[model samples]
Target: MRRFHIALAVADLQDSIADYSRRLGVEPTAVVPRKYALFRTDQLNFSINQMPERAGQLRHLGFEDDAASGFSSTHDVNGIEWELFSPADQDAKIPEVYGKEVIRAG
Candidate 1:
């Protein structure tokens, strides 16, 4: 299966991590110094990275699915549309897989 992680750039690593932990109700699995932090869920892997100018900005989005499965759909954020997928073809919609309320910025 193809698996990937989405990394976001933030200004305050600790603050962001804490906020996300509370919001997502899960602590990060790994924390790297001034570099990145990793949070792995059952279906998705969320990461935070420290960047100078683009802090608190959306870095990139990713998906994890079997190579054989076709791309399901895409999410439009700002003016860009991000392709989405699932670990299995029979799985629910993309928004259901990754919380629908989660905002994706451009």
Candidate 2:
């Protein structure tokens, strides 16, 4: 089954990890390059990463499901719309910032 994920840019990995750990009651599953980390849960994958140089402000939000059938439903919601990476196909170039498998919807 597919799982939803959220990636956030943080300035301090350790502080963020500690705060999130105390708040969420879980530690990260992976830590890469001292600037990236991931926390997994039964229904969500939360990640933190360093922002790229010269990148403008960015915020991405989307959903994941075993099948690519909920985009339209979620899109119709009042404050949501089509994100750049939703309904990602097998051949889609998953962004480096994500650092996770983009499971194809069955």
Candidate 3:
């Protein structure tokens, strides 16, 4: 299976989480307090990161593929970054990017 992925920088993580949860009709799958949140649905893998300076901007675009062997990323001609990875790849990287202690399963 492959799911479209979207990552955005938001001014407020909590507010964004609430708003997105309502919009998506589901709560996030995982959240890192004051930092980030990730929501997964049948067709999408959406995430928001607390980034006031970059709020309202797209951080990147990607795909979550079950058959993917590892995580990889590249920039498009327009300089937009695109990533590809499996769920396990993301899980391994999350703790490295965001401290393990801060992540809370949702």
- Best TM-score among the predictions, by candidate number: 3
Best model number under lDDT: 3
**Model 3: per-residue Cα lDDT at residue 91:** 78
- TM-score per candidate: 0.54, 0.51, 0.95
Sort by lDDT, top down from the best: 3, 1, 2
Off by over 4 Å in 2: 52-58, 63-106
lDDT of 3 by residue, 1-106 (tens): 9999999999999999989999999988878888989999999999999999999999999999999998999999999999999998987888789887555555
Candidate 1 lDDT over residue span 1-106, tens digit each: 5556576788877788888889767887656555556676676667787676888677767676667466554656665334445544413333453434333222
Off by over 4 Å in 1: 1-4, 65-106
Error of 3 at 21 (Å): 0.3
Residue-pair clashes per prediction, in order, are 0, 0, 0
Q: What's model 2's overall lDDT?
A: 0.54
Clashing pairs in model 3, backbone N/Cα/C closer than 3 A: none
